[model samples]
Target: MRKPNAARDQLLHDLRNAYEGGASIRTLVASTGRSYGSIHSMLIESGTPLRGRGGPNHRRRVP
Candidate 1:
């Protein structure tokens, strides 16, 4: 088993790479085995700009 710090660091690295590569939060959560809130917070703490609601193909609702 990996140490706590090492595991965290690996998670961060994976998260950064996945996010930068355009992976969605859902995707990250699935792949990382992390909670949505946790992933969201990590991204925020890492200075990663959060993507707007919906995904790449998501269209804004017509008013």
Candidate 2:
């Protein structure tokens, strides 16, 4: 699969920074209008230490 776009990565970075700076999930959703699940996944993939089974735990990629 193709890599994620640079703009998207930048947005992800910005969102993470905002989240780290005490912005609530609700506030993030309101400000960016992004779904909670999408934001959560981005945060996880961006390597931000997250709660619960944050990483891809055990599933293997198919060749």
lDDT of 2: 0.78
**Clashing residue pairs in candidate 2, if any?**
none
Candidate 1, lDDT over the whole model: 0.82
Highest-TM-score candidate: 2
Q: Write the per-residue lDDT of candidate 1 for residues 1-63, one digit (tens) a residue.
A: 745687777777778778989999888999878899999988876678777776378667888
Once fitted onto the true fold, the runs of candidate 1 whose alpha carbons sit more than 4 angstroms away are 1-6, 55-63
- CA shift of 8, model 2, Å: 0.7
Tell me the lDDT of model 2 at 31: 85
Clashes of 2: 0
Give the Cα-based TM-score of candidate 1 against the true structure.
0.66
> Model 1 clash pairs?
none
Task: Give the C-alpha miss distance for residue 37 in model 2, angstroms.
Answer: 0.7
**What lDDT score goes with residue 62 in model 2?**
93
Worst 10-residue lDDT window, candidate 1: 2-11
